[model samples]
Target: AQSVTQPDIHITVSEGASLELRCNYSYGATPYLFWYVQSPGQGLQLLLKYFSGDTLVQGIKGFEAEFKRSQSSFNLRKPSVHWSDAAEYFCAFFTGGGNKLTFGTGTQLKVEL
Candidate 1:
């Protein structure tokens, strides 16, 4: 079965710090990977995606992720976190042979002052 699991339900970080969100997936084939950021009660926005080529991909808001095939993981990272970065992050994979995407539960990022 192809699925995704985000172990962390929520994470807290101080303003101007670093952040990382874990993402693990199980898929039979190498699928299209994506990271989305959603604010409180807001729709999802595409942060970045990894289809082929480089393993490390950069995204908006100074975010990046590295695709690891061995571990079946694609982790999101940010060098310096900001107050505006406080939002929910989700890892999604294109599966079921099409445009449909399966998303993880979600990891709420809270930025403290």
Candidate 2:
């Protein structure tokens, strides 16, 4: 079984501040994890992915994540968040039992000046 958990339902960060979103996952094998961002009432966009290789992965919009196998975590980070970065972020992974992706509930980001 593979599952993702984003404990934070909502988060607020000041503009230009560094941000980190928590994610935890569980699986039977080496998991392939992914991060996606979506605007309100929109589809998800891939942020980054961790298939196999170096634990750290980078993606668009200056986002990055580090996969920690021992802790079963893949937390997303940004050096400095912008106002436009405010959106619903999701953590997902393809299940071994099924080909489709199972996503976490999601974490909505709010940028405040």
Candidate 3:
């Protein structure tokens, strides 16, 4: 079965520091990858997505992810961490022509002052 994997359960970073959230996936056919963020009490919002064309896709809020087919990974990166960025980040993907996005456990990001 196709699935998304986020190895890190939680991550912490000081304000102004760079951040990276790891994501890996397994799929039978072409995969549509996505990154979403959920604030404390808000709904999940799409950060970025990679379907085709470029290997690296840019997202909102100064975020970007690179699709590495050889490694089956789509890691999210932010140049600098901010307190407002603190949220639960989910890595998701749709495989084998599915409408629903299969999401990983999620990686909680904590930012310090």
Question: Deviation in angstroms for 71 in model 1?
Answer: 0.5
Flag the better candidate by TM-score, 1 or 3: 1
Per-residue lDDT for 1-113 in model 1, tens only?
88998999989999988988999999999979999999988999999999999999999989999999999999999988999998899999999886699999999999999
List TM-score per model, in order. Answer: 0.97, 0.95, 0.96
Q: In candidate 1, what residue range of length 10 has the lowest lDDT sum?
A: 92-101
Deviation from truth (RMSD, Å), model 1? 0.7
Please give the ranking of all candidate structures by TM-score, highest first, separated by commas: 1, 3, 2
Give the alpha carbon lDDT tens digit for every residue of 26-111 in model 2: 88887789999999889889999999999999999999999998999999999999999999999988786558888999999999
Best by TM-score: 1
Per-model CA lDDT versus the true structure? 0.94, 0.92, 0.94
State each candidate's clash count: 0, 0, 0
lDDT over C-alpha atoms for residue 27 of model 2: 83
Where does model 3 exceed 4 Å of error? none
Model 3 lDDT per residue over 1-113, tens place: 68899999999999999999999999977699999999998999999999998989999999999999999999999999889999999999986466688999999999999
**Residue 46 in candidate 2, Cα distance off native in Å:** 0.7
Count of clashes in candidate 1: 0
